[model samples]
Target: MSLFPTYKRFPLTIVSGSGTTVIDNKGKEYLDFVSGIGVCNLGHRPPHVQKALEEQLHNVWHVSNLYQIPIQNEAAELLTSTTNLDYVFFCNSGAEANEAAIKLARKHTFKEKILTFKQSFHGRTFATMSASGQEKVHQGFGTLLPTFEYLPYNDTKAVQDVQDDQVAAIMVEVIQGEGGVIQGNKEFMEAIEQKCRELGALFIIDEVQTGIGRTGKAFAYQHFGLDPDIITSAKGLGSGFPVGAMIGKEKLAETFSAGTHGSTFGGNPLASAAIKATLEVIFKPDFLQSVMEKGYFFQELLNEKIGSLSVVKEIRGHGLMTGIAIHTEALPVIDELRDHHLLAVPAGPFVVRLLPPLNVSYQEMKRAVEILAEVLDQITDKTINSD
Candidate 1:
């Protein structure tokens, strides 16, 4: 194999997509609940973003960050205006954004330690991997970057007990996407902010998967009414285009002065255009409200259809980021969904994660739940037979 065996990829090779469905190499259409793992929040080839990208194609694609890009400013303005933030540092992916956040926190505070929650996923780079709290992600990568502590995710008491003087930042996710779609406890999230204030540490929210209307808001942190010092975004920022950003409050601006951090292709004209157009769509009040309504309907529909099943434990998540916690292994269920013309992914071992586009229709959600209920019932039958 020429490529690293990193992803246990599905056998289907999707050739094209529109809205909520993708056509595989065999011309078989499948409902796409994955949404490129929450990167395609606007769904495939959204018209607004596509138009912007097409227009950018005729103008320019890339330019170094040293030169001012007009669209980059527009994109940054959109981000800051939507949130209580002041500045944005564009990067290429979620990992880079988190990496920049880490660097800025340490530099601004002149401290070394960062506290992340257990089961959290930051990214794969050495620094980001160290920031991640999962052991499997750290396996075989000896001698990680230092001064990161993993505390229990929703344990308010654990956060209250942290009395470290060297903490530069306390980073967390409002909803732990890869950690089994676990939503952070409201009290715990507030306590984290309080602790950051108590320790004079930067409060960082990793909105990589939960941002861009995924949780029916521009950013998940908005749901908890907590102000964070730093926010990292990516996955859904560019509507499938590769882009990331680290947004921060004005007080911490000077710490990331010139030459402190940079990316070669960060916030290039093309990416900026994509980000601008995407924000123009997703940041609107009506669009975000629609996502909120859809999410409520989808979750309610799932519960009505599959909640009473023998294998189902619970269905949880905010907005379009739904997770179905099942008693059985999720891989087989995911495969069954794929076979039945639906596409969902696993959050961990037992939770099936569904990230349909923010614009997914009610009919599409009902269909997805129908397929899920059918597959889960079939799995339950097999389990009973085996027993």
Candidate 2:
């Protein structure tokens, strides 16, 4: 193979996609519940994002950050205007955004330590991988960058007991997407914010997998009435067009002055066009409300179909991001789903993660759940036969 074996890719090869369906190279169609691991929140090749990208292609694809780029300004304005943040630094992926947030937190507070929760995922870059709390991600890295402490998720007392004075920030995801689709406790989440205030540390929300209306809000943090000092966004920010942003409050604006940080392709015209268009669509009140309704309907369908199955453990999530925690390994279930012409992914060893398009139709959800029910039924039958 010419490329490095970084990903153990799925067996099927998808050639084209539209809306909630993807067609493989052999022309078989599947309901795409994975949504590119929550990156394609608006569905594949969404028309609004497509139009904006085409227009930008006619104008300009790239320009140096040194020059004035009006499209970048428009994209940044959309993010700042929608949230409590004042400034935005655009980048190319979630890892870059988190890296920028880390740099800003340390520079702004003059501190070295950061606190993240165990079972959390940040990204694959050196700094972001260090920020991630999962040890498996750090294995063989040979002495990762220090000063990061991993706390237990949803533990209010652990955050309350933080006594380190050199902590620069406490970074967390509202929903631990890669950590088995785990939701953060309201009391625990608030305590992190409060503890940051108590310790003079920046409150950072890593919205890489949950931002841009993924959870029926402009950002998932909005659901909890929490105002984060630094919000790192990617994944669905550009509707799968590869863009990330680091948003911060007004007070720390001067910390990242010129020559401090930048990306060559960050906020270029094409990326800016995609980000602006995607945000315009997802930020709409009606659209986000529809996502909420669909999520409720989807989860209800799953419960109605397979919630009681011996192999099924629980169904949980927020908005279009849902998970089915099964009693068995998630990979086998996911493979069976794919074989039945449906697609989902795994959040961990036991949680089957589902991230359908926000605009996925009701019928599509029903079909997905039916396929899931069938898959679980087969597993149940096999167990019964063996017993």
Candidate 3:
């Protein structure tokens, strides 16, 4: 028996992690800027989460959603309290959270079409994959779910060109993490929200990658000051535990009543335990303030160190969710960084994505910036010689 080869496996294999660092099977240590692709916001094996899980493990683990699961209700409450969204529907992953949002939009609006942005990534599920603007994800999967449209992300012109009653929802990412760290323009977001209102459409914000202090905010939607009818979250929701949530306004959430939606393993006791622990740490004003401060410092450091390199095109991001757009192929730099014991992932074609844990120290940020500078300097030197 063998596992499915769904991912393009990296060369390295990690054995364990503590704080913002991980050790590989070879006993080599690497600074984990990837943070499990933004899942370990509190870092690996956080004490609070560990204790919570242990306490829950001693109690019941799984139960029917039929009875009152106090912990499940508590997790939902924690999520709803963080954002403008009134209620929550728990699930297992970002894709599931997004799927729930899609279903809710259609049911609440009594409409079909869902509008998304070009280069945005929702998830890998059928509806979310169809909703994704990246065509590559849809390559082998023929016949996606119907009535989904893709428009230019952060394009105000697209906002002007809308038809009445044509869309059930206009889904967006405040910062398109998988789209090479493209940040949404303020005016652009305002336009989308206004358009959704004009067309009687739901505004859905996919914060799967940006939520839970990844961008120094409870939800990136909070940065825009625009209220969304629906917002989906996952990635860092449970500090690496597999948990997700689709949060929405009370009026819209009410449409998803008995038999309309349900999840078997979603919000089980163990998952809820992790959620409670993760939320307790991140929801604090001081913790989020520290993230905001560190994000500013990290972006400044990148500009100071790598801004002048010929291969560097731009650096864009808010808080810890940063991306560097380089001119040359990004793989060599990624490999070089790994060799230097720093781990970063790729976003789109030519960008290096940086998603350090929210609790990463200032000293760790300096180390990551130093490694990036060295690699980029070498690349620039090579390019100049070749030229």
lDDT for model 1: 0.94
- Give the range of the ten consecutive residues with the poorest summed lDDT in model 2: 294-303
- The order of the candidates by lDDT, greatest first, is 1, 2, 3
Which run of 10 residues does model 1 get worst, by summed lDDT? 61-70
Worst 10 residues of 3 by lDDT: 1-10
Candidate 3 clash pair list: none
Q: All models: lDDT?
A: 0.94, 0.93, 0.92
Where model 1 places Cα greater than 4 Å from the true spot, the runs are none
Compare candidates 1 and 3 on lDDT and give the better one: 1
> Per-residue CA lDDT of candidate 1, range 1-387, in tens?
799999999899999999998999999999999999999998999999999999999998888888879899999999999888999999999999999999999999999999999999999999999999999999998988878989999999999999889999999999999999999979999999999999999999999999999989999999989999999999999999999999999998899999889999889999999999999999999999999999999988888989988899989999999899999899988998999999999999999999999999999999999999899998888878999
Q: Compose the digit string of candidate 2's lDDT tens values, residues 146-189.
A: 98889999999999999988999999999999998999978999
RMSD of each: 0.8, 0.8, 1.0
